[model samples]
Target: MTVSRALSKPELVSEETRNRIEQAVRELGYVPNLAASALVTRRSGVVGALITTITNPILATTIEILQQGLSKAGLHMLIGETRFSPEEETKMLRAFLGRQLDGLILAYGYHTPETLALLQAARIPVVELWDLPEGDEPRTPVGQVVGFSNWAAGAAAGQHLVDCGYQRPAFFGYEDARENLRWQGFRQAVVEGLGIEPLRYNTSAIPHIDDGVAVIERYVRGELEFDGAFFTNDMPAIGALFTCQRNGIDVPGELGICGFGDLPIARVASPALTSVRVPAELVANTTVELLTQQIKAEGVGAMLNDVGSELIARESTARRSS
Candidate 1:
């Protein structure tokens, strides 16, 4: 009766009835057998994961960890790709919800009002990863969020560059707003702490190894002079590093490079890349933990948890001026 009241006519059910039902559930060892329960509740017994693109090498590891964590929590994952379009994202949301997912994990920041309203109407747990809008109001069936400070990671990268005493550092970053925060933080720190302005180049295109190769080559041919560069990500950083070596520029001697995400390649490059280590597995586990709490209606409030990041100095960025 409690399950019927809470799941069917929650509005008609009194608080006392809900509590009594919950208490009875505990005493009777009644577990939510989602397989059987889904028949009654019309849920799909799955969590919908909407991501930008699964093809990106960096995000692939994140997806792997997320899948493992979600699976361990007894939830199957249904995936949708947005192709970086808001309209497509909304469409994907409608499709995912049509299947009646028990929860949603969005790689993009937040959902549109139409999608949000639908989730509220359905009363499902939603988790937003990576980025989020500030000062969002609490909508019913509110989402629980967990992520790191991209800006803080960027600032730390800046501080590292400054501390290394590179007279001139160039910043190569992608056009994505999420990546821009890191570049902005990096630039601000370099300007304020060292009283020096770093040269900045925004990649009009998405991040790619060839993009890194081309930029470094262009700089070399044009006689641009810089002691170091902070590539927004590891792949491009590796590209730049090899480009420098090919051009007879001594890495960490004539140039220093740093990248973000600290992918395995970062540690395996000829000179291991010095990078910021983002705890992907921890982020994945924490996200699932928060979702689990939400599913149990455990009084989760507006969460701004930072899994945090660290700079690991490797051979690539280790050069000190004599």
Candidate 2:
């Protein structure tokens, strides 16, 4: 009991006893079996996180911050990449829950019924990142959402382009739920704010820079016509910029482009790409705070925390000089 208490809740143990325990631990080089400890305490001291992909810098940055926050709280983080596959995500979810994780964080909210059932059976606190569902409907498997509204972010991007005097704009992105929401928002904003219906093109489930190049190539071939374009994320936006340069299409002069997730490359591009900035650090901190509360058995309820996004305008979307 003394050893268990000392290892699990050190603050409750006396300094002398703790010192003795430490000395013994060092001499014995004994490692505590976390699985065994979890059986007694019902706390795993670990959190499981599932992200669509780590290749995206935005998601990568969020995970990094979240890991740091969890470490500061003396907790370990186990991460899994879903590769945007529901089957893979379900497998990872089961695997993590089998390990008795204290909580779970998911970058994507879309899950199958079986996955949802597994999460419910686990009864652990879950946080969904990246985007929240529209309306007041609580369709999420987990009640806690930590991230900005992709719809709002998309609307902001559209409004910025409209304000920059771009009438015929197009949207380029994947057909995923999150990207669909962004496209819907952008299209709605462009139609209402500018009184013009924007063209849209959806690529594969996994978006790549090559997708952007292809979209631009279509435009160059007169297959698509638009004065401005909004990419779901920076990867395609940057690619489109490169394609435009290669095709001798003057940015912001002949065509304006904007992207979501203000990645680092946005600023360094030849014509800096305008983008919507999702507050990754804020999202991570808030997710950790909410998860901590949940792990402590504090009822956070169905809280939807929108960290918000900012529209960053740059040379890519600059208005033509009068």
Candidate 3:
């Protein structure tokens, strides 16, 4: 009884008794059966985090910070990569909810109806990261949001391009909803700034740096002559910049380039890519704070925080005169 109590709730045991128990545990290489303990306590020291994919460099820091924060709060994180498939996310969510979790964290607010229903049914703390509901919607369907505005970020990118005196700005991105929202924002800024309709490249391909090279090649061949372009991600933007350098296309002089997710490589690139910096650290820290509060029964209901985006204007989008 004393050892179990000490192991489960160390504060309840005397200092001397706890020290003795710890010494014995170390000698025996004792590891408590969390499953059995959970059966009795109804509390699992585990939280499940669902992301689109582990390979995305954009999410790497957020995931690292989230894991470290959760660990410090006496919780363990179980990560599941849904690979951008709603069906896969639904499957992972079902399994996590079925078994045990003190809380749940998702990479985005978008989900299938079944997934939405599952979130509604679950009693654990639910957190949505990376995106917020579209204009005027006060809260996400899940009613907990901690992210920046994709639309606004896109608009900022477009506006920056125009501000740099790029007459024609084209966009390159995937067909994802978030990408579409960004394009919409970008289009709004371009139309408002230059009174010209921006081009949205028609392609179903993922945002690879090679796509950027191909676009630049078209410009070199006179097939397309966009003075500026916005890539929904930094990879393609960097690719385009590199292509420009190799083809003798003057950056921010002949062309202006901007990207999303101001990755580490964005700054170190020869010309330094211009990008919208998503608040990964802020999002992760805020997520940890809210989820921990929810787990502790702190009555934190439906928190909606918009940690606005930061536009880092580097050499890629520097003024034409500069």
Best by lDDT: 2
- Shift of residue 184 alpha carbon in model 1, Å: 2.1
Q: Each candidate: what lDDT?
A: 0.76, 0.87, 0.87
Pairs with backbone N, CA or C atoms under 3 Å apart (clashes), candidate 1 = none
Cα lDDT of model 3 by residue, 208-310, tens digit: 7887898899889998868999888788888889999999999878899998889999989988989999888999999999999989888795578889998
Model 2: per-residue Cα lDDT over 194-310, one tens digit each: 787889888757667888899889999999999899988899888899999999999999999998789999999989999999889898989988898888877685488877889
Question: Which has the better lDDT: candidate 2, or candidate 3?
Answer: 2
lDDT of each residue in 216-275, candidate 1, tens digit only: 898788756677788877878989988988998888877889998799889999888999
Candidate 1: regions farther than 4 A off: 1-39, 110-122, 132-142, 223-225, 298-302
**How do the predictions measure up, each by TM-score?**
0.80, 0.91, 0.92
**Candidate 1: RMSD to truth:** 8.3
| Backbone clash numbers for all candidates listed | 0, 0, 0
Sliding window of 10 residues with minimal summed lDDT for model 3: 135-144
